[model samples]
Target: MQNISNSFFELLNKIQEKKKGDDIQQYFAEVADYLFKHVAIQAGETRFTFAEIEFYYYKEGEFEGPLYNCTYPRTRNVGKFFWHYSGMDICFESSEEKKYFGGILIRSIKRGSEIIAGPMRCSDEIMNSCDGELPYLVYCETACETPVSTIRYGIEADKNQNMKFCFYIEPETWNRKREGVLVADKATGRYKNVSKTDYYIAEPKKR
Candidate 1:
C-alpha cells in the first residue's frame, strides 16, 4: 500500500502528471465515439447525436445512511477516480467536439438541519470538538466495458451488501502507476492528501 503524507486536498487539485505522447487521449476519444454511437444506433439513426448526456439518481424521503466511495483498492488504485470532491469527471473526445461526462451518486447527507459526512452522522456536539480534519469514505459505482474485458451494466443489491464500494477501472496499464500523488508544493513546501477530508465532504464534519 502507498502511504501519502500530504494534505489530500492539495494533492487532488494539482495538475495531473502527463507523459510525452500518451495514448490515453486516443483511447478516450474512441470510447466517446463508441458511447455516442451506441446511444444513437439504439434509436435507429446514424447521423444523430446528443450534445450532452446527463444522469441523475435520487433516494426518496429522509436519507439517513452512510455514503461510501465505491472502490476496489486491492484490484485498482482509488486516487484516479475522484475529480474535485463532488464527482468523477471524465473527458472524452466525441466526434468533432470534446465532451465531459460526470457522475456523482451522493449529493449530501443530513441529520435534521445539519449535514453529515463519513460513517458517523455529525451532530452539533461533535462539530464543536473537532479540529483540523478527518477522512471519510464515500460510495461510488460504475459499469464499464472495453473490447478486451467483460461488459456489464446496472448495480446489484446483493453485491453491495457489505456497504463497501466497487470500482471499475480500465486497462491494467493505467492502474499501477502512482501519478496522482502530490508530493510537494513548490511555494509552501508542503504536501497534500489526495483523499477527501471530513470537513470538505460535509459542513457538519467541520470544526
Candidate 2:
C-alpha cells in the first residue's frame, strides 16, 4: 500500500484502476480504515485537551473559551477515534458575514518505512458520535503540512456572536504545538459544510 499521506491521491488511483460502480466507495472505505488504525494509535493513552480559537474575518484572535471543557480520554487500544460534528457560530457587527463553516481532520499513519498523513474522512460511527455537538473539535497527529482544515458550512442570521469559527487548536499542555483553524458558521444554527478556502496559522504573539 502507498503511504497514507497521499491516501487521497491513492484513492483516486484505485478508482481509476477499478471499473466497478462502487469503486469510489470501496477505495474510500479502505483508506478510512487505514487512517483510523494509525491516527487512533498515536493518540495513545494520553488525555487530549480540546479548545476553540475565535477568528474574525480570517484574522486570528483570542481563544474562544471552551464550549466543551474537560480533558477527554485518548485510549490507544480503542482502535478508533470519536468524531463529533459540532455546528459553527459566527459573529458580526454592522456588516460582513461568514458564508459558511466546516472542518476536516488529518493525521499521519506509518506504512512500513514511510509515514503518510493527509486529508482523510471519518467513519459513520465516528461522525455520528458528535451528534448534537455543534462546533465540535478533535485532536490529531500528522506530518502533513496542514493538519486541521476548515471551511464555511451554511448561512445564518447576523447576530453579534463572539467569533466566526471555533477551530481546534493545540493542547494547552503541549509545549511545541503549532496553531490552526477548525470550524465556521453564522447565527443560522444550521450545521452544513460549505465552501470557502482560507488557511489560518496560529500566531505566537497571541498566546
Candidate 3:
C-alpha cells in the first residue's frame, strides 16, 4: 500500500510537469491513458480481472449524473449497467454463486492548460451544495470482483488553485461490507433506497 501511495504521487508529479496547452480534451485523454497504464493496471496486478474502463464527463456543477460517457472495449450499451446502479453491494448472482463487482472512480479538473487528477472527496456533499455545474474528468474501471486490496489516489485544487494530493488503501474488511440497495427513482431518475420488491432483478433470488 505504501508503495502504491508513492507511485500515485510520482504519477501526479509527472502529470503536473507535462501540462502544456489549452486543449482540455487532449490533456484529459493523456491523463486517462496514464491512469489506466500506471495506476489502475498496476493496482489490479494480483487483485481482480480487469473487465472494462469508462470515462465520464460531468459539466461543472451539474451532479444529477454524467453528461456523457465513453467506454473502452467499446459497446453499444454504454451506461446501461454501470450508471444505472449505485452502492457497493451490486453483484450478479447465479444458481451456483454470487459474483461481486467493484471499481474505482478517479476525478480530474483543468485549470488553464494545467491538469490535476485524483479522487475527489466528499463527492455527494459537493454535488448537493454547489450552486453551479461542476465539471469533472472521471476515470472508471470495472473489475470481475471486489478487490481484496484497493488504493485510491486524488489531487484537488482549492478555490485559490493550490493543489493537494491524497492517497489511501482500503482496510482489510473493506470488501465484505454491504452498502445496501439504491434504486433509481422513476420520476426524477436519481437513486433512492427502496424495498426489495421495488428493486428490479433479471433473475429471481434463489431460495
Candidate 4:
C-alpha cells in the first residue's frame, strides 16, 4: 500500500503532467462564473451563502459534480461561516479511484460577465484513516474530540501578484502557526518541503 506522502506526491505529479496551460485557472473561472450566476444572483447578495462544488477527473476528461448548500445537515459550520463571510469551497476527486485529491477555497464575483477570484488553500478529508505521514493524530484529553493535522494545497498570489502552486501544513493547535510552501527540486522535478521564507526567496519576483 502506498503511504500518504507518496500518494500525495503522485497526485501532484498527475496534476502537473495532465494540466495544460491555463487549465486550472480556467476551471476556477468557470466555477466562479457558475456561482455568481446561480447562487449570488439568486440570493440577491454580493456574498454567497455556504456552498460547495465538486469536480471529478480521470485520465481522459473532467466532469463537474453537483453543488452542495449549507442546508445539508453534515455541512461544517466553519465551512458555512467561511462561505457566507469569505468564499466557497471547491473539491476535486479522482474518478478512477473515487479518491479525494483536495480542494481550493475561493472568493469570487462577477464584474460585467467577467469572474474574478483568489484561490486559497482549504483543508479536506483525504482518507478515512489518519495513519498517513502527512496528517498526524492530535490527542487531547480535555477536548470533546481530537483533531488531526492536515496539509492543503492551492494557488496563491504573492506581493507582486505572481501566482504559484503552494502547500500549507496546518498543525493541530489553538494558536496561529506559520505556514510553509512546497519547492520543486531541479534535479528530480518533484516538490520538496521548504520553509516559507526559502520559498519566497527562491521564487523570482514578477514585474
Candidate 5:
C-alpha cells in the first residue's frame, strides 16, 4: 500500500522507493505512451462508495474497506452497473483484452442510499449520511483495452453459497477510510447486508 499526503507526495515517495533518479519527464512520457497505446481500446467505469452503518449481526467493531468496481461482460447485451465508492477511484489494464478478459470490474464500497438494482442513485435519504454529501456515484465508463487489468470486473462466489467479497485498501484520508471500515460491523455500522440473500448476484456489470 502506497501512502502519502497528496498526489505530489505520493509521486515523490514512489520514485524514491524505486531509487529512480529525477527523470520526471521520462516518467511522464512513459505513462503518456502507455495511455496512448490503450487510447482506442474499450473501457468501463470504476466507482467507490463509502459510508457508516449499524448491522444486526455482529459483536465487536471491525473495519471494512468498501469495495468499488465496474464490469463489462462481453456478449450480445452489454449490461452495466455504476456503484457508489464514496472515496475510492479506479483505473485498470486488461489482463486479456478481447479473449479471456470478460470485462472490467473494480471493487470499492461505501454506505449507499439504497441498493436498488441500478446506477449509483444519489437522490435517496441513505445518501445523505454518506461520507460525501452526495448519495450516488457517477463515473466515465469507457473501453480501453490496455494499461488496465481485465480483472477490473467484479467477482462471483465459488458456488459454495458461502463467500464474501474482501478488500484491502490504502486510503488517502482518515475520514474516508474510517467511514468505509464500519459498515458490516454489528458493533459499529452495517452497509449492505447481502449475507441474507440466497443468490445475491451483484447489479449486472457490463457496458
Candidate 6:
C-alpha cells in the first residue's frame, strides 16, 4: 500500500496532472481515510498550544488571498481546538463567509517510516461514533472539481456522513491566505464557528 503522506501527495499530483486544467475529485477513499486517521487520533489524544489555517478564493481561474479574516489562532486541547466562525462578535474575517465552524484535530506521530491515522480515519468509525452529539459537520471534497467551476466542495454533511459535502474554493489563493481551518480563542467576546454553519467567530461585527 502507498504511504499516507505519499497518498496525499499523489492526490495533489493527480489533481494537477489529469485535471490540471480540468477540475476533479481527489478520491476521499484514501485521502479521507488518512486525514481521518490524523483527525481521530488527534481528537482522542493529540494536544497542542494553537495553530491557524487559511482559505483562498478566485473569480474563475485567477486566485488570490491573504483575504479578509483568513487567519485566526487555533486553541489546541487534547485534539480539541476551539474557535469562532462568525467574526461579527469575535472580529474575525473570512472571504468564505462560513456559516458553521468547527475544528479538525490531527495527531501525526511518526511511527517509524510510516505514518498512519487512527481508526476513525478509515471509514469515520471514530468520527461517526458521535451520532446525535455531532450535530452538523462540514465536508471537504475535491471529487467534484471541474474546468467549468474551478472550485471545490466544503459543504456541510451530517454526522452520518450522508448528503453531499460541497463548497467552492480556489486552490492557489487558498495556499496564499493560509486562513484558519479551525478557530480557537478569539480576542473578541463574539465567537464564530459556534454552529455547524456559523463561520464568523468574532466578538464584534465587521462594520
Highest-scoring model, lDDT: 4
Residue 91, model 2: lDDT of 21
Top-TM-score candidate index:
4
Residue 171, model 5: lDDT of: 27
**Model 5 lDDT, full chain set:** 0.24
Model 1 vs. true fold: TM: 0.19
In Å, residue 202's CA in model 6 sits off its true spot by 19
Worst 10 residues of 6 by lDDT: 48-57
- Put down candidate 1 lDDT per residue, 1-207, tens digits, no spaces: 123323332322221232334432333334333332332111111111111221211121211122211221121122222233323222211111211122212222222223333222222223333355422222212133432211111334313442212121222221112235666677778996453323433222121
TM-score per model over all chains: 0.19, 0.19, 0.23, 0.24, 0.20, 0.22
Per-residue lDDT, model 2, residue 67, is: 19
What is the per-residue lDDT of model 5 for residues 1-207, given as tens digits with 9 covering 90 to 100? 122124322332232222223433344333323322221111122233321110100011221112212223222211122223421112221122232111112232233222222223222323334563332223222232222111112333212322222211222221221222323667656554333321213322221
Angstrom error at residue 115, model 4:
18
Q: Rank the candidates by TM-score, best first.
A: 4, 3, 6, 5, 2, 1
Sorted by lDDT, highest first, which candidate order results?
4, 2, 3, 1, 6, 5
lDDT of 2: 0.27
What's the true lDDT of residue 1 in model 6? 16
lDDT of each: 0.26, 0.27, 0.26, 0.28, 0.24, 0.25
**Under the 3 Å rule for N, CA and C atoms, how many clashes does model 1 have?**
15
Q: Per-residue lDDT for 186 in model 2?
A: 67
Candidate 4 local lDDT, 1-207, one digit each (tens): 111233332333344344433365344444333332333221211222212222222333332222211111222211122232223333343222443233434322222222222222212221121233332211111211121111112212222333322222112221222356677899999998865421221111111
Cα lDDT, model 6, residue 100: 17
Better of 2 and 4 by TM-score: 4
lDDT of 5 at 98: 35
136-176, model 2: which lDDT tens digit per residue?
Answer: 22234443221232221221211223222223333322122
Residue 45 C-alpha lDDT in model 2: 25
Report how far residue 88 has shifted in candidate 3, in Å.
Answer: 8.0
